[model samples]
Target: MNIFDLLLEADILVQISIFILLGFSILSWSVIFHRVFTLNIAHKKLKLFENEFWSGIDLASLYQKSLSRRNKLNGAEQIFYVGFKEFSKLYQMKRCSSETIISRTLDTMHTAINIELKTLEDYIPLIGTIGSISPYLGLFGTVLGIMHVFVELGKTTNNTATQIIHLQIIAPGIAESLIATAIGLFVAIPSVMAFNYLTTQINNLDQDYNNFIDEFITILYRQIFLNIDSVLNKENKHEETENKTCY
Candidate 1:
């Protein structure tokens, strides 16, 4: 007969274990599909944002674009917005030193990065947990099923003919219980594979974010240097005009 028939004929405990594993299987698959789509979108957005960010657009304009889509920002775009917004505020104040401004900007970006990464990694642990424990749970059911079969066999003190008939029933019953182990492996294998693959994608996204942060910081430094030089040139022009007037 089919596995469904075997399941129907299984002991009560084995049935319960199978049901639990089935639930785990369902939930794990749901998470797997949801996470796959979500991560795929995240990676695509990351690539698009990287291209736009490095196209030599000014920070203020890029920041404005990000602000307009505040609801959709993710990965490097979110971090850039956070860092640039803080940098703009502090730079406008003119009181904070460059070191303090950069430090605060970096801190803000780091915090945003952590938040985005955490959101990306949500529910991944559930997949991992299911993968790790489903097999052991199935084995527990298998062990119980075998123990039950042997106990039944032990009680048969009748003639070999009756005992043989008893074993005919016991054999299928034990095989039915081992189905739990099979189901466990079924649930575990895909979940483990999905967990590892999704984690790797998340890690790659994080690395992209880090690289953008470093590049943005360098860009900010160059902007700050140019601003300082411009201000110094203005002061020099003013001094020269004053000297000419005095003479």
Candidate 2:
């Protein structure tokens, strides 16, 4: 018999299991497609932003450009916005030491990175859950179908003239039971593969974020030192002029 015929003749429990597996398949595919699209866009934007960041542009100019798209910023750009904004605030206040400003800016950027990662990971766990449980659900249906076949066979032996167990009688029922397992694996395999793939992408992005944060912090420290040196040089020059006038 064809697959449709077997499905039509399947036990009610087996049909329910098939339907549930189909639902999981649909849901998993939806998440997989969505995550693929989103991650692609995110990676593209990350690369574009990184190129702009290292192109010898001034921080204030970059910060202004980023502010224009503040609501839509993600990844490295979002971290830069929060960190720079905090740095600017503390620097302007002049109440905090350079160390305090750098510390607070680092904290702000870390928080932004965490929030971005969480957004990237949305709905991932649901995919993993479906992958893990779909096979078991399918197996449950198969077990019920096999039990049903055996019970019907027992009833048939009591009514039939021949005390014979036929392969033809048993094969179709077993085939129907096994279809559930087939459907279950169908749903599970892609879900597991997609889950692993997306997880790797997220991990790679996480490493990129950490590296960017470290580099940006180092830049901030250099800028702070440059400003301090410039101020000290101006003071020393003024003192030298005063000493010459006294002589």
Model 2 has an lDDT value of 0.86
Question: What's the number of clashes in each of the models?
Answer: 0, 0
Model 2: residues with Cα > 4 Å off, grouped in runs: 158-167, 229-247
Highest TM-score: give the candidate number: 1
Q: Against the hidden reference, what TM-scores do the models get?
A: 0.89, 0.88
Tens-place lDDT digits, model 1, residues 170-217: 899889989999999999999999999999999998888888888899
Poorest stretch of ten by lDDT in candidate 1? 238-247
Clash pairs for candidate 2: none
